[model samples]
Target: MAEVKQDQVPQTVGFLEVILTGPRMSGFAGPAWPRTCTIYVAIADEVVAWQTLPFESDSDDFKKWRLGIRVPVASNWPDLSLDIFVERADFLFRRRTNMVVVTREGPHTSGHTAVISRARLRLLDALVLGDMDDEEEEKTMKRRRSEVMEGNPRLLEGTVPFGKAVKLQDWELPAPGDEHGSPRAVVRGRVDVRMNLRPAAFFG
Candidate 1:
């Protein structure tokens, strides 16, 4: 498992620990496998966390790999649900050759959705653990939106490319074990969120 910690912090900040494991490639019948996989974590449909995992073709080393990412949760966070998305970065779809089949029954088929991406959102618990009234919510929303926009102007300009991301509700609880690449298999993962209330020394 890979872990990272924040060092420069005099401000009050919470931590969201996300564990991604048991990634599998299913329903893909192509001769060439995906070269990489990217995971996106979202809150209220806005991306808050993104992690890319590059496949090591040598020895098929990524079959049992596990990734751990930490996201900082600040005060006045918006009230929303937590969502996760996984995309096959190197999925080959646009090709004249019938090299891949979408279904197992078919031998050779083309024109399959080239980019295979799946998503699952865990809404069993309220993502916004903080309590705030309408006025506070409005202030917090504006403040957070400003922060986000300041960090990435493209988001505010609506220049980022987005898709109709899919979300799976039942797959929140994945099956145990090392079934990373099973057909329609959900990745085994969990999220640990902790809240902090210390005062901020300086705004980043």
Candidate 2:
């Protein structure tokens, strides 16, 4: 893991990509879905980070998800982490002639992992919200809801909890011209942090 100096922190407008994996139910059997997700850059003390919207039918093709976060230059911010959750519902069935039946399938075990950034840590009094400007909050809320209802139930929401400090492992760089062009001299790794999914008060 690379350690960054407090004075040398980069501006918070760079791109961040996140990868998510696990199993999901198909028409019958379950299968593995790997997805690559992206996020537009924004500044926040700590906000939700997801590979993509949770409800899309085609979301399984991605191997990772990208989140765009804007880190404040002057604020003291701690290293970053992730939170995840999954949603499930029950159903009822009818028998052949005149009988009715009901059944419940899940309470599915939704796995949560926190991706921790190994960069230098800063202690901030309060994290800043992203620039909303002319964007209405309702529009953003609708977009987020659509993602959750689409069947893909992995949702990255909630604030990060404090715990034992973890060290980020080193990741091998991709070959030249693979996707990021020639491999630059940058170190990369992610820490998977566990999260609780129950609803809490929103303090915005």
Candidate 3:
């Protein structure tokens, strides 16, 4: 096998964790549903990640999931985190990012959408944990996991890079038993893009 250099890739890769408020009837202003809603994170027509939210009556725990997003060099914009409804970032062709795929009468329908942006990455240092706190040796591995991302590009963001410039080894990473590559940043936000999810397309 050949070791591929991160620099030659045209897309940005990232791991995402989204905290959903609920299976609401509408937007954040909508009433929360007692059950769960299947959510997806996508770029262009590619559905990169998806999760069926779990409902809990015991606590106010919102749905959290970690997925990946790929941003091509074409749509590589610094302000990808801005709300999709904005005039500048506005997208009318089948709402993408942080969405719930469902069936509708026609290809056209009205809906609300929000994407989280400028989120802080939760730099995970195992030595920082209580179990691994006792280890005094040099940190072996390190990983960067995005926080609960909300808002809308479904608030999808990734490590900085433009055209094969992402070198994970050169990125900020250090910790034994920890692996790091192109650390990702995340936040708390929500998006509402309704569509249908066919598992065969993504899973196949």
Among the numbered candidates, top TM-score falls to: 1
lDDT of 3 at 11: 54
- TM-score-better candidate, 1 vs 2: 1
Candidate 2, which ten residues in sequence have the lowest lDDT sum?
A: 122-131
Clashing pairs for predicted structure model 1, backbone only: 23-180, 24-180, 24-181
lDDT of 2 by residue, 85-187 (tens): 3222222334565543333232222232222112222222111122122457436544544554563233223212221222332234577568865533332
lDDT: which is higher, 1 or 2? 1
Q: Which ten residues in a row have the lowest lDDT in candidate 3?
A: 161-170
Best by lDDT: 1
- The 10-residue segment with the lowest total lDDT in model 1: 156-165
TM-score of 1: 0.36
- Evaluated at residue 152, the lDDT of candidate 2 is 27
lDDT of 3: 0.28
lDDT of 3 by residue, 1-204 (tens): 988898766553332222223332222422332232344544333455555443342345443322333333222332232111110111234456755544332222234332222111112211122112223321321221122122113222432111111111112234455665444442222333211111122322
* TM-scores, all models, native as reference: 0.36, 0.22, 0.24
In order, candidate lDDTs are 0.41, 0.30, 0.28
All candidates: CA RMSD (Å): 16.2, 18.7, 18.8
